[model samples]
Target: MSQHTFLTLDEVASNLKVTRQTVSKYIQAKELNAVKINKSYRITIKDFENFVNSNSTSQEPSISYLRKTKNCTLQYSDKSDDFEVVHGIFHGELRSLSNNGKLTPNKFIFGDNYFVMKKLLETHRGKVDLIYIDPPFGTGQDFNSIDEHPAYSDKLVDGEFLEFIRKRLFLIRELMSDSGSIYLHIDKKIGHYVKIVMDEVFGYQNFINDITRIKCNPKNFARNAYGNYSDMILYYAKHRDNQIWNDIRESMSEEKRKELFPKNHSKLGYYTTNPIHAPGKTLNGDTGLEWKGLKPPKGRHWRYSREVLDELDEQGLIEWSGNGNPRKIVLAKEHKGFKIQDVWEFKDKGLSYVEYPTQKNHDMLERIIRNSSHYNSIVLDCFAGSGSTLRVADKLGRQWIGIDNSTHSLNVIQKSFKEDNINFELLEYVPLD
Candidate 1:
């Protein structure tokens, strides 16, 4: 007998060319044998083989058929099939260019991202923890540095651009771990179509947030529309609800603190108060009885147990009004950070203030990396323009991989990395011509 191995829902889904939810439905319907393990489902190889063999039929729906049956899909010219794209052969190899003389998992690949990422799939398949790509925004314009040096081009637009991104997205999906995530920063003009493309690749259910990033100050351009001071980031998870989420929060602003915590105590600093009594009544508990010669209010119970309330009052953590109403005092110093929302404001600087054109804000990249990846996880940026994502990932103590083909981008990244003393191996994609 052969030793049995178990596969996760994502693994099964990938092999079956379907969504994880589809595989879950099979498990729920008892069509596929699966066992619960650590709050997740696992299918033995034998059982999975048995299910596929037993379910095999002459009229089984094809992957293209399945694609069409999706509740929603982006239909465009030259759209490749998922199977063809995932298994497509790109005739290229990653040739090592330089070794930093130290053992490092970090790499900087100089090549077209599409081919480089395909080569990466050989070793890094389903291993990347986080991906952040600021690809071309399909503006059909060339970008330049402050010195008028040509940086990159974004001439592909319409269906050509969509297909280009869609093809790479399939490769990106293959490179992501089951708990991985991707954040694609793009201009708002083409971001909507890319959203549909993401939906097709990552599945709509896995779509996380369309983060509206305020990238610049409001511009008073003479146009027929509002000032386009913001771009969008399409955030998606490889598997919904299973991606790495540190739930990092933002600290309260000083003005916001002053507004919320209006009262100030010379001894205790800023503070606020909340009603001590809650809505429900505690009929048979000590909370129903009076502690300081006061009966329980009508249909209300003490927020805390009577003993706890007594302790709070003794500790001067309670405020009593002139009419004898008691409230709990909350100090500003003890405040937890506020939850981060979908909208973000991390403005980018001018071309003169940056080494590379369209260099992103460091703080924004930091927030994404800190929230979505661990210290030991591999963070990848295929369209690594200025290598800002790689720098931030390195700063956060994460392993990073960057891929770009532009000479200017490589020059900027090399100089910047050398200044920061970041060591990494460099490789180039070589065609077997």
Candidate 2:
């Protein structure tokens, strides 16, 4: 209940530019005061200051909070330095592929997304508000459309795949606004590793959710494992607690309504009864007082004040049992929809029903855009498979950008956009040499 006033050994070590072992030595030697709480030593700020002041020499600068808090990072064979990844050069240029006859913020880049994203950092850094990308799943296979057209390749595997994603994530983090968020759709096989990579780019505290998306129906494979029917979407914010979150809810279905609001009322339609008291006791409030000669149950407090409870009883909103137990009537119409959870069932259609291979569900994209962005926000999809994210963002009145290296993806996006009467510019990444 109190503000956090203690620091962990790791935090102290990071701030002092030393190791946890060194901080432990200071504690063991009784130089720094610390308390043992739940098997871990927690040093208070006052004591830490005392230790620092007592140890620092006149010639040395006083130490402040100089280092970042320790965080988890994925280690792979070819992982590059974060600084190098952020400053890496891409010898490519964005050239206009087509004009939409009007000035618009929406654009599609038909080129390698890595290079395209690097180019974007020059002007669009910290401008994009939301991003949703569904990259290849590293299955070591080639993807093709329903008509046998080559779509994209997923040749990178293991450490190579991880490094590839890590490099792009560094660039993506730079392109994100302070309040921006990104949702990465990935298969469960490699999603965990990618999550750690994201934690390295975006701090671990910025992670919002690991959404389990039911991508398809149960598979009848003859493997010694459970059916693979789902994938995961890793969601993270550029800065924790700052990204736009609309808290969109899912509408209740007729089946759920019948199940929850089973009782029918003549005037209030379908309704249900709820306990008038909540779990915690209120010792010095009106909720703790008696109402209608009845007090709240033991260890509980009235959900409403006694005056409000009296008003509800007078309005016939409180139902009384034969034994004098009372419950407030809840109308189904007054109930808001169910809160959307991490597990979603927006299944993708068959290959023949989609324009591109591995095209995601439109409803899923709609949910992501509606919840993570606003009308004026800029939505970007670097691995813009079938351009579903861009289309959804456009439909939701948000500006959008799409980037992909696959010509098949480009053609599919162009066709879909034209059919939808969406006006936007197109560009291509041309190599310099």
Candidate 3:
């Protein structure tokens, strides 16, 4: 197997018992990596070896070994129909190291999305609190192929991509618990189409937010407009009334803290209080009662009931301006981080990109995963390109199911997880070996 010497095309043809024309065809096709020296075609011994090794009849082409790694699995506490099972998962005590943390492989799925989906259904369906995915935008990789080869189209046109997403989105909806929400990622190319599809399935009014992510510094484009710089993530729920969303409160800023609580020094944690009344009528347009010597502000009403005010005043939660409106006392720290801004973004904070075109940042993924999901929640990324989504989900103590058709992506994801110390918390490693 030591290929210390190069081989000529004629020699390769002879060795493989192919004709010269067949060998030349491969050379012209760039299928064989050969160098040209003074009109002489020469194949490097390493390139020759790699070519030979990559020619394995497996249905999948081997990828660069040094490029990526992996070792993690999505697990579930319940089971259901429709989800596929991923067999041949390697079982072992192997581990991986990472900068954020270490992990060990607890389970493995050496199969495709449908295969993995079955397993997820068996394990996590109806148990997930949130399901967020950044599916492939239909890049025509073998991963998205239904017939086992790379599709010739970018993604199916005429609602092809729509239907493609619709199928998986429906499954994700089924897998989620009644209180769950789904935040899907897509580019503008089909973001709206995908949204329409999601509305058709998940209901339109259930739509929450359209999250825009800043992926890069804006890659160079030949277009008339500015180079594209963001990706849109659409949020939706199964039922608007059935969704589980916490109305989180953020600590007041230093200025806001002092401005509102100017006379207080309660710095334990920043908090805020509502004034005696809100400058608005009731939701039904009914005004509130007068207090002391003043009627509630015009078109406004008491934010709290007399009984609630009495309780707050008793608990020191009430603030009086002596001559103006009454304010409630709150810890300035009670304000959550920035009121959960609609635009979520991350710019080269500490992590570097994977260098692959269209690769999402792991740092960006961490934010989405943390904000949308919780510990041990079920997360699904059907277009789970690069597997970064799954990697972050695993680290965040979440169980996940990632479905990608690209053997290249699968390889990148696997190797990324394996080589990383991400496998310490894991149970074992079943390298696709």
Candidate 4:
């Protein structure tokens, strides 16, 4: 491996934005190292860099300094000191409810997620691979079940609500592995503020996509605004480039199949013809050479080599039009599914069809879990309402941890898991002195 150049004491002090005396003090205290060169002191770049957390409260300030120096960052009141208040002393224990003589990775914790997630840091810090949370939007209203039973309240609004989510986010960031990703689903009314809060906690550099999800059918309400039919999901990764991404695609619908692949061959079935020549000319390659007394179209080149083009023709995979123009035949059945876009349409079921209030559609959970996580990875949902995310993770062969405070949510989860014959350890949070 290559090594960094050495620096003088004065150079190190200037780089650290501190006095030479402070740098000397750190060197004397062995927090940082320096070599005695001739009559002066010199420090290696690595040795000069080891004094990061010697005086600060945490490593976050150093990270913040580097980020600010390198890129633009968002700033908000109470943002710098917010984590200091919430990140301390988690006093709780995991009480396993139904273990089958083995320690199961899947867990269902019934408690306020703030303390429960902090408690999880002891065992799960930097271990979770994916998290999908559908937290209560700051609507300042209480949600009720179909029978008029109270489900949960979304009464916290504005700054208070944002702080509540922000505190949990700080702890959630600790639980996420370097390769982990989190998706937060919220309504448009408060989604924008939540995005800013997320950028603050997860770093603006790690922010990924603002996915618009069609949550319901179009509405014709008497309100002045346009019909509201969608919500947003803010996706962020612990580290942008390291996050797991499966690149799952969506299957083509019948209408799309008919529109794109209208022609049918007796042996090959539904297919469409694409131009054999693509844009951009190859100066001196096989793609520029003549084939079967025909040259590629002007200002373009053959999509394949001359040998491959002949093979395709021999295999009857090339279509010749009446004007003697040749194109490549693409079969619909052999086509890979279309790439999924940022906008999605997965409507939730009506209230009467769901087990709990605001229960999300399982298909949406399936898509998220399949795309952002892998089999056997740990998936977490601290704001698990009806346990849709946990259930979907189980179905997808991922170990999951679900936490919820509402008794109704817990009851719904228990009933759903029991009916589905899914085995999981149920834990209740107990405070410690």
TM-score on alpha carbons, each prediction: 0.84, 0.79, 0.53, 0.81
In Å, residue 433's CA in model 2 sits off its true spot by 4.6
How many clashing residue pairs appear in each of the predictions shown? 0, 0, 55, 0
lDDT of 1: 0.87
What alpha-carbon RMSD in Å does predicted model 4 have with respect to the real structure?
8.8
Q: Identify the runs in model 1 with alpha carbons over 4 angstroms from their true place.
A: 1-71, 321-324
Q: For model 4, what is the error of residue 178's alpha carbon versus the real structure, in angstroms, after optimal superposition?
A: 1.0
Q: Over the stretch 252-323, how does candidate 2's per-residue lDDT look in tens digits? A: 789999999999989889999999999999989999989889889999999998889889999989999999
lDDT at position 276, candidate 1: 80
Candidate 1 clashing pairs, residues 3+ apart or interchain? none
TM-score of 2: 0.79
Ten residues in sequence with the least summed lDDT for candidate 4: 65-74
Give lDDT tens digits, candidate 1, residues 246-291. Answer: 9998998999998999999888899999988878889899888887
Residue 300 of model 2, lDDT score: 97
lDDT of each: 0.87, 0.85, 0.58, 0.83
Best lDDT among the predictions, by candidate number: 1
Better of 1 and 2 by lDDT: 1
Q: So what's the TM-score on candidate 4?
A: 0.81
